[model samples]
Target: MASPVSQKLEEKLVCSICLELFRVPVTLPCGHNFCKHCISDHWHKQEQAPAGAEKGYTCPECRRAFERYPELEKNVTLCSVVELARDGEARVSGTERCEVAHGELCPQHGRLLELYCEDERQCICCVCSIRQCQRHRRVLFEEERSKKQALLKESLEKAQEESERIKQAMQELEERTRNIKDSSEGLRSVILSKFTLLRKALEDCQWRTVARMEQEQAAALGHVGENWSLLKDRLDILGQHRERAQRLLACPDHRAFLQEFRLLPSPESPEALLPVEFDVASVVEPIAEILTNVSRLLLEDLPGSVAPKAPEPVGQDHRNLTFNPETANKYLELSKGNRKATHSPGTVCGRQEQGPRFEPWQVLCTQGFGHGHHYWEVKVSSHSVILGVTYHSLPRERQQGHKFNIGLDGGSWGLQVREDCYLAWHRGQAEKIQEPLYKNLGVSLDYGKGLLSFYGLGERTRFIHSFHSVFTEPLYPVFWLCEGRAVMLCQRD
Candidate 1:
C-alpha cells in the first residue's frame, strides 16, 4: 500500500549482516555494510579478524565465513533512498546558508563549499567565493587545512615543553622546602641546648647566694640570742638583790640591815673594789687598742680582700676612744705624699739618697697595745738638734690632725708659738727627767711657747714649754733621741 519511494527506503533499512531490514545493523568481516559501527566495533573489541580471510571472524546471525573478499558493493538503491531521506530531514531542520557578502552566487560554479577569503570576514562556499572574494586574498579549504596542521604541531610541542618545565620546577621547590625544614629543626635543637645550660647556671648561682645569706643570718641570730641570755641573767641577779633589800627594810629593827646595805657598794661605783690602775686601763685601753687594730686590719685588707668580717659590737673602751692617731696619720700621709710614696713608700724611700735624710718611726707599733691608746716619750738635750718624724711607709699631711717631733723640716719645733701645746717622749725619758727643759733650759729661748708632757709608769707625768703653740697639722711620731742621754718611755693609763 505504500509508494515506491517509501518501499525502497524500507528495504534500505535492512541489516547487511543478517540480509534483512536493518535492526541494529551490524558490520560483517568481509568489508560489508551493517548498522552504524556496531558489528565492526564488536569485532575490534573482541580482537577478531575480518570475515573474508581463512581465519576471519564468523557472522553472529548466519555464521558465514569467506576465503576471499565477498561481493560487498555499497547498496546503491539503499544509499539513494538514504540520501533522499537525509535531504528531506535537512529541509525540515532548516539548512544553513553561506554567510558570503551580498548573497552573491558564483558565476563559474553553482555548488557551495565552506571556504574563506582573507578580507571577507566570513565563511564562503566555493561558488560564493568567485563573486565575493574578488578583492580579497582567497584561502582554499585544502590550504587552510595544511596551515592548521602545522600550527597544531607547533602548539603540541610547546605544550609538551611547558609541562616538562612545570614538573621540574615542582620537584626543585619540594627539595628546597625539605632543606628549610631540616635547618629549622637543627636550629631549634641548638637553642634548646643553650637555654638548658643557661637555666642550670642561673639555678646554681641562685642557690649559692641563698646559702651564703642563710649562713650569715644564722650567725647573727646566734649572737643576738647569746646577748639576750646574758641580759636576762643580769636582770635576775638585780631582782634577787632588790628582794633581799626589801625584806631587810620591812622590819622595824632594820638598823643593822641598813648598815650592811650601806657597806655594800652602789652599782654606779662598781670599780670601787677593783684596782684603780686596772679600772683606768680597762676603760681606756679598749678604745685605743680597738682603733689601732681596726686600722691595721683595714690596711692589710687593701684592694678588697676576702669578704669583710662581721662588724663586732663596739666595747665600752672603744666608745670612749677619740681619734685613732695611726689611722689619722696614714690617711693624712697618703693624701699629701707624692704618687710614688702613696703606692709603695718603702720601695721608693729605700732607693732615695741617704735614705731620705730623716729617720722612720714606728708611729703605729702594734706591740704595746693590741687595741688601746699607748704613749711614748722623748727627751731634749741641746735643743739645736733637729728632731722630726718621717713616715718611711707613707707621707703625712695637716688635714689628719697629727703632730710629730719639734725640729726643722716642717716639724713642730720650728719657732711657732701658741697655748694648749704639749710634747710627747719615749718611756726611757719619763723616769730620768724630773723637771722639763721649759722650766730650766734657755738655749733658743725663742722656741718656748709650746708645753711638753711625758708618758711613763702608767701615766702622763711631766709638762714642758716648747717654741710652738697648739698643734694643727698632722705629724709623724719619730723623735731624735740625744746620743746616750735621751730616753724613750711607753705607757697607757
Candidate 2:
C-alpha cells in the first residue's frame, strides 16, 4: 500500500551501513547515506586494524576507497523526508497520532500540536502557530519539553534549600523552648524552698511570742493575788474591831467595855491598801514590741544578716552590689565603703561627666545584667526615696519635668515608698502596693521571664509588686533620693 513517492523517500532515508531507517542521517562526500553512529562504528573497526592494513577505508555502499574516514554532514533534505515517511507509515497502520482527543485538533489543518508558543507558554498545532503566534517566539514540542525539565529541576532545588532552612529554624525554636521550660522548673523549686523556710521562721516566731505573752500573764496574775490576800487580812482585822466596839456599846456593863478596850491593844491601824498594776497596756506593749522585732528581723534583714544560710541570690552566686561612683549624681555622697548614698545638701564643684550620671539625684549599680536572675537589697531610711532598675541607655541628663525620674516614667521601673503607701512605677504608670510599710526592700529580676519583683523585708518577705515585660536591654539597679535621704546596699554575707 506504499505510494511510489513514499517508497523512494524511504530508500533515501535508509542508512546503507546499518540497512535501517536513518537515525541522525549523515551524508558523506560520495553522496552515500549512513547513520552517523553506524558510520563511526564502522570506521572505528577500520582504525583498530594493523597500521599498514588501515588504508582500505571506503564508503560501505559504493566500496569507494578513501584516504581516511570521510567527514560527514547531516543530510537536511533526508531528515525532512524521514519525518514525513514516519508519519505516513503511522497513518497507514492506523495508529493514534494525536495524544489528546481528536476534537481538540487544529480545526483548519487537522493536525496535532507539534509546536509551543514561547511568548504565551502554551502548546499549539503548526497551523495555530502560523495564524495566532506568528509574531511570538516559538519552539518545537520536544525542545520546549527539554527547557521545561531544566526549569523544573532548578525550582525543585530551590524548594529543597528553603525546606532545609525552615527545618533548621524549627529545631532552633524547639531548643530555646526546652531551655525556657527547664529554667522555669529550676527557678520554681528554688522559690518554693525559700518560701518554705520563710514560713517555718514565721511559725517559730509566732510560737515564741505566744509563749512569752502567756508567761507574762501568769506572773502578773500571781502578783495581783498576793496583793488581794494582804487586803483581805486588813479587812478581817477591821471587822473584829467593829464587832468588839458594838458589843461593848450594847453591853449593860460599862466595866466590860472598858476592860475589852484596854485589852484590845488598840485595834491595829488598818494597813493602807496598795493598787495592783495588771493593766492590759503593759501586757500588750511588750508583746507587740517582741512581734515587731521578730518580723523586722525575718523580713527586712533575714536574707542579708544570715550569711550562707540566707537565700542564695536567684540564679547566681551572692554578689555585693553598690552604687557606681562614676554614675552617681552630684548631690549624692557615697559612704560606708561606697555602699551608702546620702543626699548631700549641695553639689560638688567641677563634677565631670564620667560616662552617664543621674542629674536629679540618682545613681546606678556597679554591675549591669543582660541575662539570668539577680536579687539585691536596699536599706532606706524614710519614705522619701525611690529604689529601682533602669537600662544603661536611660537618659542621664536632667529633664525639665519629672518624666525621666525613676519610678515616674519610661526606661526604668521603680518602687517609691511614700508616707501613705508603696508605689510601683513604670512608663508613667503607678500601681500601689497595699502591703505594710517596710524599711528594707529586696528587688529581684528574672531577665529570662521579664519579671521584676519587689518585696518588703521583715521577719518574712512580703510581696510588694512586680513588673513584667520582655526587656530589650541590659538592666542596672538605680536609686533616687532627695536631700536628707540615705540608702545603703546590704553587703552580701
| Alpha-carbon deviation at 427 in model 1, angstroms | 54
lDDT of 2 by residue, 25-55 (tens): 7888787888777888888787788866745
Native-referenced Cα lDDT, model 2: 0.73
Regions of candidate 1 where Cα sits further than 4 Å from its true position? 1-111, 118-123, 248-493
Against the reference, the lDDT scores of all candidates come to 0.39, 0.73
Q: Per-residue error at 419 for model 1, in Å?
A: 61
Best by lDDT: 2
Candidate 1 residue 360 C-alpha distance from true site, Å: 48
Q: What are the per-model C-alpha RMSD values against the true structure?
A: 27.3, 21.3
Residue 434, model 1: Cα distance from true site in angstroms: 82
